[model samples]
Target: MDLFTSARKEDIARGAPLAARMRPRTLEEFVGQGHILGKGKLLRRA
Candidate 1:
């Protein structure tokens, strides 16, 4: 009925990737980005 509930239903219907669906919902929930997504890290090293 509300935007939040509708969006969640859409996400469920689309069957988004497990990683994407389970991604950190907030910056505080994020983990160990220092290894992959941190500033000037491996992902950005290329």
Candidate 2:
């Protein structure tokens, strides 16, 4: 099935709490864990 659609994103955001909705889209946007999550890190690739 073709998941990860934009419509689904909107639906999820609509149902999510304000804190969850305000969360970052990627690890790069997320603060902390930087010492472990540097460029080409295993977690980033995962």
Candidate 3:
């Protein structure tokens, strides 16, 4: 099978890892409590 299918199968077999569970699915969906990942703050500062 292709990489996408294989990865999905592995994900199903192993379930989501701790780090995977903590990943932000999208930019808007990210749970940003700290100012580090806040809206364009760091990027603007850089």
Candidate 4:
């Protein structure tokens, strides 16, 4: 990533709430909520 893009992302994250900043950027990094996101689930399939 370029320095400008990296700085922009860092600035955005710094301004966000802790919860928002801590949220997983990808489904693979997510946890819990298995009832909806578990394997074979409709949302997971989508």
Candidate 5:
């Protein structure tokens, strides 16, 4: 890839959340906050 392309990609990566960089593509794949965010919870329903 060209230098411009590489720089742009690096910028995108740097700008993203650490969670997004780590790779969980769906809510089912997401982790943490089970006390509030788990299935059938009021927050999840909202």
Candidate 6:
């Protein structure tokens, strides 16, 4: 919520592994898991 907190998060993300940095942060950004991510599926229901 403060400047340092946000800056630290950015720095950590910058240093993270490529996969970690590229991972989807939201369901809308996810793909290729239709069996579990489809409408009415358990993941969305949660």
lDDT of 2: 0.80
* Per-residue lDDT of model 3, residues 1-46, tens digit only: 8999999998775786878777777555656544765667764356
Cα lDDT of model 1 by residue, 1-46, tens digit:
9999999999785797878877787544668676776667766666
> How many times do residue backbones clash in model 2?
0
Better of 1 and 6 by lDDT: 6
Is candidate 4 or 6 superior in TM-score? Answer: 6
Question: In model 2, which range of ten residues has the least summed lDDT?
Answer: 1-10
Error of 5 at 28 (Å): 19
Question: How well does candidate 1 score on lDDT at residue 9?
Answer: 94
Cα RMSDs, all models: 5.6, 5.4, 4.5, 2.6, 5.3, 2.4
Lowest lDDT sum, 10 consecutive residues, model 3, at 25-34
Please give, for residues 7-36, the per-residue lDDT of candidate 2 as tens digits.
798797799999888888877886878766
lDDT of 4 by residue, 1-46 (tens): 9999999999997999999878898876778778888889978899
lDDT per residue as tens, model 5, 1-46: 9999999999999999987888976667667868777989867799
Sort by lDDT, top down from the best: 6, 4, 5, 2, 1, 3
In lDDT terms, how accurate is model 5? 0.84
User: How does candidate 6 fare on TM-score?
Assistant: 0.55
Candidate 1 lDDT at 27 equals 46
What candidate 2 gets wrong by more than 4 Å, as runs, is 1-16
> Can you give the TM-score per candidate against the true fold?
0.36, 0.44, 0.32, 0.46, 0.43, 0.55
The local lDDT score (0 to 100) that residue 24 gets in candidate 4 is 90
- Identify the superior model by lDDT, candidate 3 or candidate 5: 5
Q: lDDT scores for all predictions?
A: 0.75, 0.80, 0.69, 0.87, 0.84, 0.91
Lowest lDDT 10-residue stretch of candidate 4: 26-35
lDDT of 3 at 18: 77
